[model samples]
Target: MKLREIAHSRTGDKGNISNISLIAYDMNDYEKLKQAVTAEKVKAYFSDIVKGDVVRYELPNIGALNFVMYSALGGGVTRTLAHDMHGKGLSAALMNMDI
Candidate 1:
């Protein structure tokens, strides 16, 4: 199953960083997500776009995970020639991850 089946994501971008919050639909799925979603996996998944490290922050109480991706905005919104300067599509891209 893909992560989208169990969770949804929100994306934000600032400078060259992209932040994505993955929130599970149910607490029951949190454990599965925690085990399956890792910084390394995310980094590899977006390797072509993200140029720097990926960091994951756990939010057990909320059944959510926040991923901070560095150097992902093509050198920031104002400077980048990338189509999606805000990286909004990133959330949908993440949902494509197999879980």
Candidate 2:
């Protein structure tokens, strides 16, 4: 399913990179989601599509997951098209992940 299917996103722009803050909703079922999502899990969730790295930041207080995926936007603003960069296709790709 898409990230939107499981969690809500707070998207922000920074230089060429985008920061996507994720909070799992009731739709994800906390216990199941806790077991399902992790740093390694998030990385695996994005392994193929992401070219650079996926950094995970856990928020215990909020019970949420944040991943800062880099170099996925065709070099962000540095690219010729200067495309959407900040992970243009990420939402769809992340949503497709099984877990």
Candidate 3:
């Protein structure tokens, strides 16, 4: 599945880091999404494609998940360590999940 097919992304740039926040369009999709996408799981999701650190924060109040992908070109060059292509970045990346 593509990310545009599942969720919408709200993106922000804070200095050298980029913050990508994801929310479900259909509220009913929350549980399914939560199960499929997790903090640890997200780390794996972006592990190969992203370098530095991948931090996942769960917001229970909003029933949403936020991903802080460090050194993944928020406002800087791509990570020098990993060669994986997280093409299109987070916004397009999440939509591409099989879920």
Winner by TM-score? 1
Query: Per-residue lDDT of 35-59 in model 1, one digit per residue for the tens?
Result: 9999999999999999999999999
lDDT values of the candidates?
0.92, 0.60, 0.63
Pick by lDDT: which candidate is best?
1
- Per-prediction TM-score, please? 0.95, 0.65, 0.67
lDDT of 3 by residue, 4-87 (tens): 555677776444455677787777766766787765666677665455676777766665678887766533535434332233
Clashes of each: 0, 3, 3
Candidate order, lDDT descending: 1, 3, 2
Backbone steric clashes in candidate 3, count: 3
Reference-based TM-score, model 2: 0.65
Native-structure RMSD, model 2: 3.2
Lowest lDDT block of 10, candidate 3: 79-88
TM-score of 3: 0.67
lDDT of predicted model 2:
0.60
Give the winner by lDDT: 1 or 3. 1
lDDT of 3 at 49: 46
lDDT of 2 by residue, 1-99 (tens): 544666665665454455566677763354555576665776676665456666767765675767777765555656627444455456545556676
Screening candidate 3 with a backbone cut-off below 3 angstroms (N, C-alpha, C), the clashing residue pairs are 2-95, 3-95, 3-96
Q: What's the CA RMSD of model 1 in angstroms?
A: 0.9
> Which has the higher TM-score value, candidate number 1 or candidate number 3?
1
